[model samples]
Target: MAARAGIASSSTTLSPRVAQGGSNIRGEQRGKKRKSPCLSMPLFRSPLSRMLVSPRIQLPGIRLRSPLVGHRKSPYAERRMLHIDLNMEVEEENADAEERGLDSGIDQVHQENAQNCFDADDDVPVALEDEETGVDPGQENIQPWFDPFFDSDVDDVVPVPQENTRKNVVPDNDKRRAIFDAMLVKARKGYLKGHESKEVSAQFSVPVRTVQRIWKKGKSCLDQGIPVDVESGRSRCGRKKMVVDVSRLEDSSILSRTTIQDVATQLGVSTSKVYRMKKEGAIKRVSSSFDPHLTDQNKIDRLRWCLEMLDPRSVPHNPVFKPLFDYIFIDEKWFNITRKTVRYYVAPTAARCIRTIQNKNFIPKIMILTALARPRFDSDGNCTFDGKIGCFPFVTHTAAKRSSVNRPAGTIEMKPIESITKEVIRNVMIEKVLPAVRAKWPREDAGKPIYIQQDNARPHIAPDDRMFCEAAKQDGFNIKLVCQPANSPDLNVLDLGFFNSIQSIQYKSASTTTEELVAAVDRAFEDYPVRRSNKIFLSLHACMREIIEVLGGNSYDLPHIKKGVLERQGLLPLQLRCNAKSVNAAILSLRTMADT
Candidate 1:
């Protein structure tokens, strides 16, 4: 009865499980007599702790044990039971306090501790006491430990720094820029099917923010049956132009401002603005070379020359032009050993090429006399004759006078002719020029007299030079020497572009000696494409029209006729049609002057 009193009095001291109607013993074991209710009750047992029971019933993830069997209860056992009951009462009171604290929503320290205990499974431990020792269980009222975080004043934590890396992205292809935008829209609609932004971005190799923007733009596009398009920006929304009245720059009075910077300063605009104007064809870049100061006699001579070039059969109506294929252009040019400046591409680790010369003026140079006629082509466009008569250099081979690093004494060496006199020109025409004309002239044109055109340089032999006239009547051939107006280089095919073309290729092959320079010039001349030479003749004809338009004044830009396109389409004309009005006006102006 005393044990029964002890068990009943301690009913208020029961744990949460017992107070909530939990039992450790099975229902079948409850009918048997025991020392006290506490004996049948589990000692220091928790729902979290493993419960030992008889083999009759087993709970998953739990340890079961049979009730302890004894003949009688001892005083020590009674005292142990009292101690356990007292601890249970203390724990019950603590649990009630914790619940109250939680309800009040204050005591954040305890709340944080409870949160930690809930987060970590092993935070709150359940200890089982030894039935034999009767040792006092550790702390009964376990108030949750205070969290250090609650005592601080900080709201946000500091984050670790991250490195910002930049990638070198190439510019978008201007040709396919529209296609790229459309692809972006289509990919966003197809690949971003309810997935995260990063997933879609990784799949498409685009930024996450870009993917988000694409999705946001594509939201209502599909539903509304409107095409998804990304607007880059409104046109003309960039930096405003600081200078607007650019027409002032077109005044001829502003001709002194030749460079972009000079024009920019005068107009109070950036140099880039001036460059943009140039790119848009608002202005053009031209060489500052002065035109030939023509006299009255020079103008008359130019007009006469143009009239002679015109076919006499052509009139005011049904005008026909001469083919001019039976004519040859001859000119002299100084071929230098090297250019003043040259550009080369080399590896970063390569050794630099050092070109040493004692003096640029003293550098080796040779005078080359080149002759060419209009190339002949068949109806099928196959070249019949290349019309390259030959190029002769004014050089002679002689034995080396003294020993030098370049060559030993008595070694054969090439030397340039320093003095080019009229006699030298006469001899070259007789010996070298006339022979080439006979050897390469087409058989059909060989029967007709061919005109050799040359510029009016003082060193050039006259048309009636005794030696040249004697050489002209040879092997049943008729060749005449004709001199163009002074300072009218544009009239000849060589000065029109052929010399510049040869120089460009000759400079490509670096030469240190006169011999190498001559060889390089010859190779360049030989390799000069025939079609390019043909184009030069057409350019000569174009220049003649320009001269006639300006009344023999050299103040005209070279006309770009898209000759390459014409040649490719087989529509290139053999001769340009001269404007009949210009022709008649020129003839009338000359005749009127003559009549006066």
Candidate 2:
């Protein structure tokens, strides 16, 4: 058959016959050949083959037939394939289960729980067991249990141990006895020990000197081996004599009556001295009518007038003159460049003999000249510039000596006489004085003649100044020069209003150089207020009126007024308002205006 099949297959003549068991046969003998069990039916013939076969591989355990295979079956091979398919299906199912678990977030939850465990272990530094005596001392232990107020509530009722209480103690009775004994000992000590006083007197019940004396006497008693009987000494005391009767000497006896001069002669004293003694507490005045007390309102008025006279702005009509010039005021003081230093005595100790000499800087005295114009009432009764003007010149003469003794001494050096000369005066008048005056009265155009009033100083009517004045007169200027009483700086309103003000302001400042001194003087001048100048004018006018009133309304007598008369009897000197040069410039300008 095989040969026949082979021949047929080769010849391609009849239909080929099939052979089994890996043999190939070709024949169209329908029932002649046997089939191998491994072979299945053709895939095209099966309806389910489409679901089983693909281009790459077939499904596990699925049978597909070749075209040549007929009904073929291998039981063992089928069983083996079935087993492999089942194994692959079981592996795929397990992998699917694992993937579903991951999607449900079970693995992520486990990971976070593991991290929390690690963090909890790291929070505490040490274990509680390690903090106790279980750990060695040298080994580091992080945790410890401590209580701050472990012994706060101990017993107070129990007597404190020796170590718990303070050591020092004092008995009150012993202290009192010791103080008493000290006082007694002090009473026995001599006055020499008492002289050395201390500041402890305020604290002790007894004097500080007594305490010192007690201490000394206690030491002396101890050294001399003497007993101190404190109680017995305190018990002893002394008494003083008392007067019983008192009598007075009677001056009513007619035969014994004597004149004050006769009594003074008998007593070998001056009559005035006798009267002074009688007026004072020393002796009694015999006559009741011998009233030595004189209420000289004129003197008071004169004094008040003098003060008013010092101020150029003050007039007799003003009521403030009595109070304003009652105190010393200095202004417009000038100092020489050379004499700027002042000497003072400094005490090294409280002892008078231990004084140390030193030089302090003080502003030197300067020549201050000023003017006071009387108030001229206008048609409306307002004060105008038509009244008579008074000029006052004050030379602030500082004592060059260490002592500022008011009395004129032969040894005291005076300021230079030529400092108030025509040249200096003219320069100041033009440069500084005129500008200030013009600034003060810019609106006033007084038709009255201009007058320059001054004291009887040589500079007041200097020959050179007189020649200058003549020259000015030739130019048709109505300049009149008036002289104040000799040595009468107090009468000059300029002396008080302008010059005194300057001196007081610059008194404390010491300028070593001429420029510095001049600057100081200028500063002082600037410090004065314009109202002060007005006050000075008022004061001067008031003084003039007072003087006129004192003279029974005739006129003010300049000659009779003393040069050194105080502006107010016990009051301060009047301060000048502006500089001398300013006053002079005002006068000159007024003169020029009058001439015009």
Candidate 3:
């Protein structure tokens, strides 16, 4: 019986016949199972009680008894299966809620999320979360800043143009750096309204988290009343280098190595490092043209020769050197028809020159006998006579034995004499050199003592030769022949630098035949500037002084004087002044010579 506000229930005893049928069914199941009072009430079951008797769903961690085997064939089984499936779905939802740490309000929150419409400025939910703890799955402790609205009145604040910012971003010290910093500050501070990091990031094309950090630092600086500045990077954060000691370059251990790479290997450094040392002037490059190997006696002879040039009268006082105005310098050189190697500049599309020589070493050449004297200049610095006596080639004219394309048979052609014997040198001195010197000899120096300075070559005749003596006696000129120190070309004015100058000018023209070569050399000799010969005479004196300085060793650079300028000012002296210390040094060296 049920008595409630909304329901009235009356129970009547069932008839004997219906009760007997139910009792017989119950007694029949009681024989196969334990009798329960709940099973006995099936005859008086109410609607709620009938529902409780239907199949119940089994949840995880809940135990349930099996229904009677008779219900397995009942018509309610299909409906009971559906109820079980529904119960399973509800349990799974509860389990998921527990895993996500959500409270019981999770379902209401989910429903609200699904039903609510997002406005243009509404914050978007990024992920689903727990019901009990209200935390997103797998995000327990992270509290990332979320500002979707970015509330600010400066929503219309225009960002600095990217092109303007990029254009002015140079290295730190550049003037454009001022503009870059200004633009960067303006763009970053635009987000200061509510510290909207995402807006600043989007405006500047930077990461969201990066903007957050930058904004944080800028805010701190603003609070301290300091201007916000973005640092480029940590200073001096580059690779470290192992510096090598360069002072060791002068050490004997290092100097023994001849090559730069060799030195670098010994010092444990790169060749570029050594090259830097050279470029910085820690080392030097020099092409050493060694002196002719001289014995001790040769050194003594050289020393003696240098001493003879010093003026004895001026010694022990302000020493002055002899002008040697009447000294004639003579030497022989073989001028080649053409250089072995030559460089030329041509148009890009032009053909290169193809020159062939039978033998580079045996190129057509002729021996030229050159003679020069000290150029004489008047008080007004006008050259009274240039020292160019004459440049004569040791050549001859002979009939061609056979006909060729260049010339007919028996044609008299000028040809170079390959073997210049002593007779040839004597003839050149007696016939060519003597005649030219006599004709070109200054009228004032007609009778003065003229010395012919020649190097010690085997082909050169002795100074006391009868032919030279006879030749010297003519014209009332007391011309004497003198030989410079053996193996000492530096003492000869012709060999000092004049021959090289002549060759340099001669090579400028391409000569194919020996006669052309001879002509070219002769022209070069004449083309030599008279002023350059005067310079060479002064340079001869300079060399004499250097010989004294080095104790007869020719290990010195040619001293240079602006002779043209001096000549222009009327200050060019025929004889360059010698250093007194050098004269004394030469005398001392000669004195210390061994008797042997």
Candidate 4:
């Protein structure tokens, strides 16, 4: 069968050979019978038989599949194959790949070589090679491939050209260099070193280290007689010293022992100026010398007693006695009451008799009523006075005595010179005195009995006056009569300050009659200044303090009349009990005098 098949394959070629188809083969000539068209083809035949008998097989009419697949070769293919071979050899030589024993394929090798070649030529423009025709590397005038498009003569499609204008470029490098140079110059002049290098760094826009390096390198030259740049010299005003004035300090020394603080305060200067003055020996200090003993008990007591004599109810007892001693020490000139001058005029001897118009000095008599703890101001007492013709105790002897004949006939002679009588005393005590006393000491002495101080005179301790006293005791008031010292006026601060003031004013405007005198006195009393009242009160307070001190800081049991007299003088005692008739009469006298 094999021989047959080979002969059949040979015969198919012989037919083509006879007709110039020698290249072609015939199936029948080779002893391979041609099958009828009606016969079914055999399945799974031998390889040679199939090749010989396959009618579909064409001869010499076949074409190459692709250029790369064909047996015919080109320079490009040969070169590519050579490169692939070279890459295979290289991959085989690689120790790492060889150790793994990986046998790479020719196609894979070719692919890798192609990838590496592309990578190598990535930056070179593809058009550059096309343009290079045959240019040598040294040829500079070889136009690039796209030059034809740019040429004016060629019908080239050129894009419109844009104008090239210069743009703003920052001079960063030059500025940095200038800053460095400035710092270097500063360092060379010795104006920057250590701390100064840091300052220069801040000022010149350079690093501290750079400034420091320049400083150290230039410092030796700077020290060795190289003068500093004038630009880097210390500011003239910076090193100038401050000067202080010493003349101001000398002026302060004129003040006596004044401290710098005091001088500063006085002159409206700063304390620092004063301190500077002290340092310059311009001022000295002085100590104070004030006596502390001037405010002793005796003086304080006297002052207090004087104050209390104004208002006995409120005054302390210790000071009440102090007024006595203080009064004794007072200058006699303070006690003497000067009589008012009388301008006497002789009337024409026609009205009744050869008459002198009696130009009398009017002094209103203050009827003081007082009570004491005992009947010591009675006739039996040591402090007695001739009430008829002499001044009574606690009464001022400023009025003159008159003869009986001179007294107005038929008129109630209730004059100041009248002698004391029981009826007269009773009338005065009940009508004038008691009421005035009550007005001052409004609250009757309920617990401890109060005394009425007076001189030993008929009017003071008379029978009627005694009876009146008894009647006062019955009416919830413990009344007593006291005997005052003879001729003692100093004990009364009120009399010295207040009453004296009233009398002085009244006497200056003398009156011719008793009515006129009363009116003048009343007007004068009313016109007493508020300041005088205040002074009188103050004096009484002083006297009370004195009395308190004398009594060892205890209470005073002094006569009520003494207290009343003080109150009246000070204008303090507002409560007084007097007969309405007497008060009315006094008021009438004042009114009448005022009218005249």
Native-referenced Cα lDDT, model 1: 0.66
Better-scoring candidate (lDDT), 1 or 3: 1
Candidate 3 lDDT, 386-468, residue by residue in tens: 88899988989999999999989999999878898999999889998999999999888798889999988999999999989
**Number of clashing pairs per prediction, in order:** 5, 55, 9, 66
For candidate 1, which ten residues in a row score worst on lDDT?
54-63
Q: Which ten residues in a row have the lowest lDDT in candidate 4?
A: 325-334
> Against the hidden reference, what TM-scores do the models get?
0.60, 0.28, 0.57, 0.25
lDDT of 4 by residue, 1-596 (tens): 23211112111211121222112222224224422112222322232332333212111111112233323322211111111122232223333334533224323333433343234646443222112123233332322212121122433434343344444322244444454456666554345546656776677655666555545444555567684322322244475743545445455544532565666766566888667756777655545433223233433333332333332442232112121211111111111122543444567773442324335343334342222111112333232211111111123234334446555444443344334455655665555554544443424234355554444343445323557766656546555554433332334434436556766787777465544555565566556654344444345444343333343222333323444456457553322222334323433444454465
Cα lDDT tens digits for candidate 1, 384-456: 9999999999977899989998889999988888999987888888889999999999887677889999988
Off by over 4 Å in 3: 1-267, 560-573, 594-596
* Candidate 1 backbone collisions, by pair: 51-63, 52-64, 52-65, 53-64, 53-65
RMSD of each: 17.3, 41.9, 24.7, 42.8
Model 1 deviation from the true structure expressed as Cα RMSD, one decimal place: 17.3
Q: Is candidate 2 or candidate 3 better by lDDT?
A: 3
Residue lDDT tens for model 2, 1-596: 22211111111221111122222222234444555333432222232322443211121123234446564443222311111132233235335536544223323323433343234656533422212222233333322222111112322223323333443322243443465454454444433333333423333444554455445555576668897422223333566433211122243443443677666545556777766767765765544322113233333433333333333553323323332211112123345544334455767774443323244354333444433343334454344542222222333344555544544444444343334565665554444433433333214432234445555555444423654455434323344554544433545666645665666666657665443555666666555654445456545544444443443121333332322344235332333232334234334444454465
lDDT of each: 0.66, 0.40, 0.65, 0.38
**Can you tell me which runs of candidate 2 are displaced by over 4 Å?**
1-447, 462-466, 470-477, 508-510, 545-596
RMSD (CA, Å), candidate 3 to true, equals 24.7
